[model samples]
Target: MTEIWQQSPDGRPLVIDPEGGYHAAFLPRTADAPRPLAAFEPFVTACLAALPEHQREPGARLGLELFLLGAARRFRHAEPLADEELLAGLADLFERHGIARGRLLDLLGELPALERAQATRQVLDEGAATVEEWLASHNQNLTVRVRERLPDWARDLEA
Candidate 1:
């Protein structure tokens, strides 16, 4: 079924950037096709990369959902997101697109791992190590530990 999203159920719009301040038009639905959010994942993933940087803010969190709806509403548009950025991109996503905040957390199952990866990246960056070194060293030991704890498919290419 072809999808159509006027805006996220909550009502923020989609915005992104290499520099973080672009807005896409929100077109209303004129068709009856069910909006399959799952289909928008890849597009949301790509827009996640261009999302703006901001520290915690409760009022402005639906970024990911808005992007998902936008792209699902217009899928033929951009590139898919890379695996590494998906979760962090998503954390930011929740704020800007959430319909009921609770709705924002539909994928709560993914957060623990996402947090671990972000922490790993922070530790690696602080250590000033190369990506290769970060992978080789036990510097961000949490990421490794988390991978060890999860099922095989949960692991990344590094495994």
Candidate 2:
């Protein structure tokens, strides 16, 4: 079957099959697309290069998610994102990996963080802590540690 290729608005590759079903395709960066973390491109490239060839696409996508999460938390004061926004970001990543949004939502609904985030929201609503404070407290765990270390690994790739 012949494949028709298009780029999603966020620059992910979309493949349209003869039957008109869409699939995600991991493709090389195009000139017109905005560079993600342009200042850290060298580091990102080196880190991706170190991954096994077959794993590169998924690894790169995960790295992007981590970078976004770290950046969002750092700049939360200037640009606050609701829980839905963070969840939407993960959904976008899953879509880029060829997972349907509905499936992604179903998967996320099963995660422990979903309940924790909701409970935290209730606490915040009760004025027990500000949104930022609640977020910072909850996000300080293993997942955030992993996300924060990703950039460090990327930087280390330059050594």
Per-model TM against the reference = 0.22, 0.25
The whole-model lDDT of each prediction reads 0.33, 0.40
TM-score of 1: 0.22
lDDT of 2 by residue, 87-107 (tens): 444344445544465444433
Off by over 4 Å in 1: 1-40, 76-159
Q: Please list all clashing residue pairs in model 2, or write none if there are none.
A: none
Candidate 1 lDDT over 91-135, as tens digits, reads 344444433323443424343464365432332232232222333
Candidate 2 yields a Cα-based lDDT of 0.40
Model 2 bad stretches (over 4 Å): 1-79, 113-159
